[model samples]
Target: MTNQQDNIAALLQDMKSSVSEFEQTEDMGILQRIDADFQRFAQLVTLFLIAERDTYYGYFLMSMAFRTNYAVSTIAGIRLGEYPPVFETNPLILLKYSLKEILYIFCHEIDHVVFNHPAEMMKSNPEGNPELFELFNYAADASVNDMLNAEIKHGKKFMQAPKGVVTSKVIRNKFRLSHVQPLESYQYYFDLIKHHANMLGEPQQNGIAPIPSGSAENNASPNNNAIPGGVATSNAITAAGAAGNINDHAWTFATEHDEPASESAEAMAEAVKELLNEVDSMMDGEARGLMPARFSTAVARANKPPALNWKAILKKYVGTIAADKVKTRMRLNRRQPQRFDLSGTRESKTLKIVVAIDTSGSVSDKEIEQIFSEIFAIIARRSFELTVIECDEEIQRVYQLKSPKDLPNRVEGRGGTSFTPVIEYINKRRYFRDALLIYFTDGYGEASIPRPLTYRNLWVVLGNTSNLSVENPYGLALPLEE
Candidate 1:
């Protein structure tokens, strides 16, 4: 047993050293920050699990990526089945926000993972009412805030894996959370969680006091801790004894709280919106008080169904996308409208084309048909034989299309989507000299494609391309107008 313990200890030390080495090698400190955040999450989950409250596992699955359709603090996407959790960082966001927000962002994702809340928040409510969706947003925001607050009260911070030891900021690490109004968007999300828990007969701690999302009114809350010189935890200890006993305390905490319902459908939802309002009020008062209400008030102004005008939104988002992303486009053959002029003139070059497609179940039948129509139109107009391949995970169908009618009745395989085989085929099958590969996807590719040869790759993303992070610095990403 002693030898086994020693081996485990040695392994952990080695792992930490390796991580430290990697952090140094990659100047991007985001990974180091992520590591810390993940550690905190593991610890929090451990407590919850010890208390026999495992429902919060959803938090780990949540992710916060930098480039998104919305400028909102974070966005989440869902997939079916249990998979290891992932966290993706947006380089642009890291440069803008404080390191604290990054930790907050990490916590937000961890909250999703801990709660194991599926990405149902993004889906339209069963009633299909936009108001319900808004309400749901509020509830989620509230829940998230509540969890963060609860974690803080417990003296939790991002630590290392397995043994979550505090390595960085305390709950008092005030980023937007401290100054921003309480029950603001994400804070509201946390609040909603607590509220829903209460509605289901859970405990509610008073005196922690709630503040308006944007209001500076009554900033003197007794519970608000000021780090390094702030409120000290009465029970917080640096020793392993404290850490080891966390599970026991968690179990005790569970006994003190009310029993959670197996389900609290409507009430849970209502809690979400109120929370959303609280959060949004802090960030953009007009958007929350005005835009949302306006969107709800009379007839829906943009009620065309939340369709994507990619050309329009992309144009707006392009200005905000990092310079590195723009430079990535420069390396690819596809072109966006130039913001500046290059002093030297260059001659136009002709390129071959390859079209890879994801024929997955999440893709609507009509969407697939429309995508085919568009591709055929583009191919018919252009003077090239479209090298078309259909895939879910592996290359299921391959066609050298001379005419649009050559398209198959159905691209087989309804399994998981993978982009590797088609990418390998394109890079290796040298039939098309200087090919421009336009991939049509619902943005659900599993294996990522490497940077293609000389601007030849074009992700003609069909659905929400925001769901996928094509990490290639030279990848061309253009989403279709849904």
Candidate 2:
């Protein structure tokens, strides 16, 4: 056998070893289907060997952990056989019904080696750059879709498409390599592999497919050398494991596998033992914080106050006083003060302001800082108890903003635009009467109505009037005129 075949065999063996550990009692049908698929793949390899006897190609098998599937990676090196390698008469078609698809996928992988696509893509793009990979995946997916659509339209069996017809046209048309930097060169190939995996039934661990790195620099090795999520390592691999054991923060498993069947079973008893030890260590930190007479350190820090002027303090006090006066005048004799009211309380009813902030890519850091400052100022002046809910495709984070300081240290998330989460959040937390939901966002979000919640919602749009027509059903969307 050639060196390429030898490597391929070794890769297959390693994958089998890894997958053997998974308790396969439940998915017998799936396992049988996979075995059939492998048999088909093996036949294709036999044909490739007969056609090109001495060609320098390297093949490796990968066990797709998430989908419980298998895949092969073939790399072409030095040509050991003659050019335009002749095919055997009785070539075994791996996927009999979709020969064209199988061929396209095969050629796509081979092109990675032939064109040095991985290295080219890496040199042109930065490591872990999602945008570059996204562009590449879309391009490849579009090309594959176009072919699929054409086959359906022509009523031609896709398998009938002739071999060796693969072209780099899609890759070229999709990404402008000339304009790209060297660091990004790896992304195109990575995207190609990732998209190919998706096209195949076997997907990768994170719903996000991984792009294989061309060089050692591009290798998509795990950040921490770890086994598959299901298999136990030095520790448990679950979010509960993370919460119980702080050191297990890096441990990540699929959502379905988050709660294991036998968390306290004898087989997994070792994990529970180690997890308890880690929990003890974490609790020690909190235990120290709760120690009585811990106020001395805090008092020492408070004694040395940073320089502050009466003018600044006066401005702050005036705003607080003015807000308090407005509240008192509005409900002078109508409402009685509750027992919880203090002498310096700013408002009779705490302002339940729902601060909805935009987290789209268009929002700049400076803009964020400025907007946060304004929100903080308003919250501080009005002494408003805030419930800041941020959304962008959905409500990514919901933070309780009892103090103005929370505005500065809030979590940031950015992506697609949707306003449903904001409305949904408001509707859910309807107990806050006299609650005003103030949303600070670019008016590019979709219109969404707040469900029958007890809270009053308001949208404070942060963008030019040109895009002000975006509808909001929950409350009046007041756009900030630039």
lDDT of each: 0.39, 0.38
Clashes of 2: 17
Q: Where is the poorest 10-residue window by lDDT in model 1?
A: 245-254
The number of the candidate with the highest TM-score is 1
Worst 10 residues of 2 by lDDT: 240-249
In model 1, which regions exceed 4 Å deviation? 1-351
Candidate 2 lDDT, 227-345, residue by residue in tens = 33422222211210011111100111123344432331222223222322332233334443442221223223333444443223323433433222223333323344453242322
All-Cα superposition RMSD per candidate: 23.7, 23.5
- Scored by lDDT, model 2 comes in at 0.38
- Cα lDDT of model 1 by residue, 1-482, tens digit: 23433443344344334333433353224333434443444343334322322222222222211211111112222212112222332221221222233344445544442333322442323444433333344445345555465555555443112111111121112111243234333333433332332232211111011111322321222231221221112212111111111111010001234433322222333333333333333333333343323223212322224344433342343233222121232343334345344232333322245667777766565766676676555444344555777788788878777665666766677788877777677667655435556677767655446555523456767545676645562455766765
